[model samples]
Target: MSDVAIVAAGATRFDERIPRRAEELVAEALLEAFDGVKGLSLNEIDTLVTSYFIDARQVAEEWIIQDYIGHIPRAAFRVENGGGSGASAFYTAYSLIKGGLSDVVLVAGWEKMSLYRTLMANELIARGLDVDFDFDVGAIYTACYAMMAVRRMHVYGEREEDFARIAVKNRNNALKNPKGQWKRRITVEDVLESRLIAYPLKVLDCSLISDGAAVLILSSVERAKEITDDPVIVEGIGIGTDTMRLGDRAEITNFPACRVAARRAYRMAGIDDPVRDLDCAEIYDSFDTVELQTYEDLGFVKKGKGVEFIEETEIGGRLPVNMSGGLEGMGHPIGASPIAEIAEIFWQLRGESCNQVDGAERGLVHSHGGAGTAVVVSVLGR
Candidate 1:
């Protein structure tokens, strides 16, 4: 077996409207990635993996992107696992390189979500749930997360204002991220006053329906040295899944899939204590409550202490989390989100992130799909 390294990463600004097709967005990201790594050519890539959730326009999106990007003759395919598609695609590319099946691989993810109305996009996202049971019962995506938030509050005595603080913290961090969708600093009062989509989650608490793309170039350890001097090594990767129906889970307060995945990743990375071992993190924050629960599930804090952990995850805290504003402020483009999370970690490891964490050497990236039914956790270090 061989080691894999991420040599270059790129992403377009996350926004409501990018004014371009998904393939075009991918091409832009690939060009930027190429610019970062000197002497790297598209022809040198032995495999291409793309990730996207909805079929906004066409099928076989990977083939379409390969044609648009002029990377023909290279093996290419698509991976779709709801919101975790991007990280799943990245894991596939890492496996190829680690197994010695390919020396160089290109991983990209994009979503042109602005093409549809908010209601229509919500409908599309709801398809990830059980069609006959959940979706047909008039369950919107927000409601799924809302139920979890309600349960967490009921069991742990957490208040809505605690969740609001998560939104404010991430939005404040977004002010430093040039590519963040919402750069304006917000307050806990602002989140509380916002329109309530569900019982506990306000409009400001939800992630934006963004349009964006991200790309990463991975290579074998031997080839990485030849391509770039600073390569972020893929230390560990783990994927886990729970029931598709949120009701099937024994506990709604925490996502078991995230706990399973994070434990595996931490063990593989030789991390006995996530809070002390990890320098920073980029976890999926589709909803502010989700981020709070993830802190407990990821072992960053003790269970039922997620609310208190908020201050500890701030910019200058013990272990900064979501320095890229997470999905709340960075914008969640479904397929592109997980890839973008890894890109943020890569930049942090290289001291190039817009909101760099001081002396960050090891970082974690987490992504979830289908109401926590699936999770992918990865550890990266310089």
Candidate 2:
């Protein structure tokens, strides 16, 4: 086993239309990511990993991708873990390289959510949950988060505007990202007044259903230096799971999965105090309360203090968060969302992001699937 690093990272514009098929979108990201590798070529890649949740077309992800991308000679695999599938695929590539299974791996995550109607697409996403308990009762993902939001507000006496602040900050940050989906500058009042989807969750609170893809090229540290001088080392990778059904969980406000995952990530990264040690973070803001809950689960602040972190968590504040505008404004393409989070951090480390965190060295990316049932945390550094 040897050290592994992300030598290249890239993504397509997160819009409703790119005129490219889902496979083509992934190919485009692979092309852009390969460009970042100085001397690396397609021949150097030893494995290919891809993730897609809404591609109703049952394409053999790795096999078809190989024929399309010119990396057919290497080993290949497809990984799925609901919305966390992207990060999970990356983890798979990491395991292969770190365990001496393969040296260079091309990992990609993609989705074509815009192809289906809103109701049908959401129903497909709901299929990821346990069918017996959650689906039978008509519990969509947003509805579960709504329960969490309601419980959180009751526990802390927090206002709906507090959740609105999450939407506002992320949307404001997205204004700087040319590839972001939601770029409009909005206010707390705007969020509060928006049409409600579930109680306490407005249209602004949910992430966009997008058509996008992202790719990252990873290699052993020994091979990384030969490819690029500026490699983003994968310092710590932590992934965990909670009860598949929301009703089975004991607490709604705190994500036990995130609590366990973040601890492992911080420990592996040698972080003593995340609030002071980390330069920035990209938590899974699929909804406003999820991001707020992450603030507590990640130990950035004490429980119930997430609302207060909102004021100081912006671009120039203490430990700037969601520099990519997060899922709320960045667009949630299911499998592609976490990969976008990774791409944002890669840019921040390279000083290339539109919303770049000033002097960011050590950064964190957190994402979960189906209302905290599946979670992953990764710490990256230059």
lDDT for model 1, please: 0.92
lDDT score for residue 176 of model 2: 87
**TM-score for all predictions?**
0.99, 0.98
Which segments of candidate 2 are over 4 A away from where they belong?
Answer: none
Model 1 pairs in collision: none
Put down candidate 1 lDDT per residue, 1-382, tens digits, no spaces.
9889999999999999999888889988888888879667888999999999989667888888999999898899999999899999999999999888899999999998998999999999999989999989899879999999998888999999999999998988988898999978789999999999999999999999999999999999889988998999999899999999877789999989999999888888999999889999998999999899999999988899998889988989998999999999999898899999999999999999999999999999999998999999999998
Best candidate (score: lDDT): 1
Misplaced by over 4 Å in model 1 are none
**Model 2 C-alpha lDDT per residue in residues 1-382, reported as the tens digit of each score:** 6988989998988976566777798888888887887888888888888888865656676577678887766788789898899999988998999999899988888888878889998888988878887899887888888989999889998889999998999988988888788868899999999999999999988888898999998999999998887899899989889998777889888899998988888888899899888888898898888999999999999999888899778999989998888888888888788998988998899888899788999899998887898899999998
Determine the backbone clash count of candidate 2. 0
